[model samples]
Target: MTTTSTYDVHTVRAAFPILQRTVHGGKPLVYLDHAATAQKPQAVLDAIGHYYRTTNSNVHRGAHALSAEATAAFEDARAVIAGYVGAARNEEIVFTSGTTDGLNLLAATVLTSAQPGDEILLTEMEHHANIVPWQMVAQQRGLAIRVVPVRDDGTISVDDVASLLTERTKVFACAHVSNVLGTINPIAEWSALCQANGTRCIVDGAQAIQHCSVDVQALGCDAYVFSAHKLFGPTGFGVLWARYDFLDALPPYRGGGAMIDRVTFSGTTFNAIPMRFEAGTPHIEGAIGTAAAIRWLQEIDTTERIAHEDDLLRHTTAAMTAMDGLTILGTASHKVGIISFVVDGIHASDIGTLLDNMGIAIRAGHHCTQPLHQRFGIDASARASFALTSTREEADMFVEGLAKAIRMLR
Candidate 1:
């Protein structure tokens, strides 16, 4: 991958109005926290606002013109999203609240397929969403949850995954990119291993979607999951994409209005595929905003933009690494634009507080991956994540502020 790109960061930054605001005492806001959630772009906000202003109506089963317009926009969003993820069919995309909800739905589906002694293999670097859902499922069903070890560099090796695979391994759950480490995982190879052993491969793409090019079919996983907000869209939206066979076989997660085809006192028939999984009145504006975001993404050169992000990350990493007493947590060779670190003799919360005063935004604490932090022998780390809208100046400011914060704490 090229270190430099012609991708215009300033132009992209202008699209996000949040970049214009000053956070603390009139200092320019340097948002280095995209991993937690991204700031919405004007195009996305406009699309959502336009929908509410012009086409605010319940979708499907409506004779009104507004409902017809809303339904078209909504279903079109599904097709747009499905195409973005390289799904074979739009019906494969089932909307959820976010990646957490998607995991819970997958957890529920996999539960029905697993027996008491069956095993679910999870990587040690997984976020709590991927971990807790399976933990709950294992407790409910008579199944076991096995952990795949993460290396010192915040990556799970192929050998580690291979050693964990067994006949009873029903589901091999993994992340496309480490949310904490930012390491790009070898999902295709891992999925191939799962397929060889008759295990279901489910990949969490919550972190990967915005950073790299992702093709669900190319990854060769049985299922893929991600949230829209991470992709520069609205909150309260996520997507779960599974094979047609799995969607047909997996039971509904909830019983509700849109998900049921027929309901009788004795029995009930559920809706088909995507609708079956999407039980209630879905988030109409969320879908519209997500589709808008995808369209905006398509309009730009994504490959170039990703290269630009990498450039910013490499620069930031070098600058942060050179600082005295500041140790970056995840040093994996392959990663997105994430820098998680802890300053010696300084609590992470204190660093965060100091950075906030300087108009710098960085995340502190376990970052929702407590196990990963425990593995590193620390309770928390300060994280500064980057997105396409992020600029080199912001990275410089963050480093300068962090150094000052460390001196203050000492």
Candidate 2:
């Protein structure tokens, strides 16, 4: 459990069984798509299996023993996530499907507080999950939506954000890390600025949480959202960490049995902070799995893990940048463990396919950030995202496969 041995990358890789598996005629699977979805460790998988096999029951409804046990496990998961994100209280953590679901929930509930002509501010570097929801809300309520521009290097300009902020700007939603560019935005600074401007800040921490430590209280954001799957947990479960007062004031996002205090022909009253947002049958097993995963991550030394990945990034970036006709996107000084690039005269899909055949799995396309891609005048790019389990050999394999693909295309 203790990784005291000078950041052993191979030791970490050994924990994930799927990493050794082969595809494409016995070729080793070199997974480089951790940003899209991380492969689960055996600990996470076993935790999930353990939940369904042993502690399977509905939570927070019945007074039965099974329900009590299930509720304890579910709430324990909430506490663990709260601790991970540095939430002030467990009541501030609301469970959702994932980052997209968390964002949509915010859009739905928070927009109810907005009046017509109020602006919702977003950045150009947002993924579609962040962009589309705000667009829908803007369209529905006739609220003006503004965008804070990103610099050529892919970092959001604080100056542009300051200029864009007006009294009418009710909410400012930004990504903590750019999925395509790997740019780490100044969330803490932006959060402070939004606070001064009387704007609520909602941060998408799906990528950032995995790369670095996230403390929601320290970041000073009104709400921070991330997915469990991205943090080596089960899919279909995520966390929405909101300020306690904000969570109390905001209306319920979904309507169902557990979220209501009373149901009558006249109307229904909603429950308190966390429970108010979580409706119907919750993903009890997923929540337990998430807690287990968080515990597993907490067992390792994060500082060393981050340092190891940083080294991998530097190595990969150097190798890729040296290649002829390769253009790396998002050269921000501050970045996550992701590299996105396009080879000249090669379609991203082609690059991805060729790499896949060589047992190097990567993501291709605009990576759900068409606006950001349009800014760079490219259709799409090949992305290689690393995790704690990634190795130097895997990074080298990606660069080697990409070089071969470029030659094949030419």
- Number of clashing pairs per prediction, in order: 1, 0
- Candidate 1 residue spans exceeding 4 A from truth: 1-4
Q: Give stretches of model 2 more than 4 Å off.
A: 1-5
Q: Model 1: clashing residue pairs?
A: 116-142
> Per-prediction TM-score, please?
0.98, 0.98
lDDT tens digits, residue span 222-317, model 2: 999999989988889898999999889898877887899889999999888799888899988889888888888888899899888888888899
lDDT string, candidate 1, 136-212, tens digits:
99999979999998888888889989999999999999999988889999999999999999999999999999888
- Assess the local accuracy of residue 103 in candidate 1 as a C-alpha lDDT between 0 and 100: 97
Cα displacement (Å) at residue 79, model 1: 0.3
Residues forming the 10-long window of minimal summed lDDT in candidate 2: 1-10
> Model 1's lDDT to the true fold?
0.91
